[model samples]
Target: LDAFLDAEDVLKVEGRLSRSSFPNSFKHPTVIPPGHHVTNLIIAHYHETVKHQGKGFTINEIRSDGYWICGLSRAVATHIRHCVTCRRVRRPVESQRMSDLPVERAEPTRPFTYCGMECFGPFWTKQGRKQEKRYGLLLTCFCSRAIHIEMLEDLSTDTFINGLICFIALRGAELDMNRLNVFLTEKQCDFVMNAPHASHAGGVWERQIRTVRSVLNATLLLSPDHCATMAIVNSRPLTADALDGHNRLEPLTPNHLITMKSTPALPPPGKFEREDLYGRKRWRQVQYLTEQFGSRWKREYLHSITTRQCWHSTKRNLQVGDIVM
Candidate 1:
C-alpha cells in the first residue's frame, strides 16, 4: 500500500517490484482517486476496452494496464449500474413475486378433482409396416399433483373429446378447470384454454407437457405405445422431498395418490440397452423404453422439480417511464 505524489503532481503506488523487470507503469501503477471524474473516465475507457464485459473483466483490464482506483470493485459496480449501454445489455426483465396458490392448488382434493390439461407430440410410431404420428393429451391434477396421459390420433375436436373421455373413464368424471371451456358440450363438461400468445398463463399444465415431452423424446425409439409414456409421466414424485416419516421407505409419487402405489409396474427383470429399442421383439422394445424412462426420470426430472429454478425472489414493479428490452 505504499503511495506517494510523483513529480507530475499525481498520486501513484510505490512498489517493491521496482527491482523486477516489469514496465514502470506496472511497477508503479498510477493511483486514481475514487468518486473523481478522472476515475470514472478511466474505468469507463477500460470497461469499453474489454468490450463491456462484467466487472471482473473491467477490473482486470484496468490493473493489467497499470491504473489502480481506490475501492475499485465498488466503483466499477456503481459505474456499470448506471452505464446505459451496460444496462441495455444486461438488465433483467422485471418480475413480481409468485402469487399465492389458489384454493384448487392449495387444497388436498382427490386426484383429478381439480385439474389442468395440455397436449404434446406427433411422436412417430410404427403400426405394422407404416409409420404413424401420435399425440399425447395430458391431464394434471392440481391438488394431488397426479397426472393422466391419453394418446390422440390427431388434433381434431373428436380426437380431443375421445381422449378426454378416456381420461374421465379412468380418473373419474368430477373434474374442474381453472378457466373452464366446454370441449364436450354434449357431456356438459367445461374446459380451459390459455389465450393466444400467452403460454405462461397455462403454466401448470405447460410445465407437465415439457417434462413429459422430454421423457418421450429420450425414451421412445420408434414403436412404444403412448400408454407406456403415460405411466412414466404419472410415476413422477409429487413433492420436492418425496421421502416422509423415519422409514423413508418410498418417495410419494403421483402413482401413489392415483392408484395407491409407488411404482407404475414392476420393471421387467434385467438390464436393457439401446440395441433393445430396435430389436425385433416388441416386449423388449417396450421394456427398453421403460428402463430408459425410469433412469432419466430419476436422474433429471425428479431433481429438476425439487427446486425453484428462476424468479426465485421478487423485483420492483416496472414504472411508467421505464424502458425495457
Candidate 2:
C-alpha cells in the first residue's frame, strides 16, 4: 500500500498510469478510508449519478471521478442493498400463495345451484333484408361446469329481463313484483355484485368468456349462427384429455352433467362392443354411464384443481400504510 501512495503529505494512489495520456484523476486517484460515512455518501452520489445503476457501473463512476476507496465494490454493494430507490425500482412484484377454492368451486352440488353469469358478443343476424345485432348471456354452473346460454335482442333492461325470464323458465325461478322486501324473501337467493372496475373478482366467468369466444370464432367459419355456437361451447371438455389405450371411457364433459351424454357429437355407426355394454337392461346402462361420469369427474377434475398452477410460493403482501405507485 505504501509503494502505491505518493510522497506528498496528502494521500493518493501513485498508479502506474502516470506516463499514460489518461486524466490526472485516473493517474493518481484520491484514497478514501473503508467503512466511512463519507465514503458511503460518495458511493451513493455516484449511484444516483449513474441513475441508480447496478454495482459495477456505480463503482466505475466513483473510480473515474478520482476517488479510490478501499473495498470499494463491497461498500457500494452494501449501500445499494438498502437503497430505497433501488429497491422500489428493481424488487420483484409482491405475491401471496394462491387462495383456497371456495365452497361453490370445491363442493359437488346440483348443477346451477351456484353459478356465474356474464354477457358477451354482439353477433349480427339478418332478418327481412335487415341486419340486427344480438348478444349472448351465459350462466355457468359452478359445480358441474355446465353452461346455459341465452341470446338477447338488445342490452335494454326489458330485453335483458325477458332473456333472464326465459332462462329461469327453462332452468327454473320465482316471481314477486309487488314489494322489494317480499321479492327478496320469495327469491331465497343472493346476488353477489363484484366491486366496480375489479374484474379479477369475476375471474371464473371472465375466463369462461374467453373460452366461449374461442369456440365461437372457430365455429363461425362453419356456421355464423349463435345457436349452433352455444351447442359447440356447451359440449367442450371439462377435464383435460384422458384418452389412453388402456382407458376406453371418454373424457368427461359439461354435456355429461347437463344432459347425461358423453358428447354432443353423434356416435359413429358400428356394432356395439361387449366392453361398452354395462348390463342387459336399458335403465341399467343409463345408471352405469351416470355412475362412471360421477366417479371420473370426482377423481380427475377435483384432483386437477387441488394444485395451484402459479403463485405456489407465499410472499409478503402489501399491508396498511404501505406506499405504492
Candidate 1 stretches greater than 4 Å from native: 1-31, 64-66, 83-100, 156-158, 165-174, 177-324
Q: For candidate 1, write residues 1-325 as lDDT tens digits.
A: 7998889987889979889999988989998779999889999999999988989999999998999888999999998988888889889756766665677765445668788887788888778888898888888887556677888889987888788888888777767732224445545555555698777667888888888778878786323545676677777765555355786535556665566322333366887888988889977787776665455444544455445555677778888877666
Q: Residue by residue across 119-238, what tens digits does model 2's lDDT show?
A: 877866667687787788888777777777778877776666666667677765522122433443555545565688767667778887787778766764322455576667667777
Name the candidate that leads on TM-score. 2
Q: Which segments of model 2 are wrong by more than 4 Å?
A: 1-11, 14-19, 33-37, 52-55, 69-92, 123-128, 153-158, 173-186, 195-201, 219-224, 244-247, 260-286
RMSD of each: 12.4, 6.4
TM-score of each: 0.59, 0.75
Listed per model in order, the count of residue pairs whose N, CA or C atoms clash below 3 Å is 1, 0
State candidate 2's TM-score.
0.75
Q: For candidate 1, report its TM-score.
A: 0.59
Error of 1 at 72 (Å): 2.3
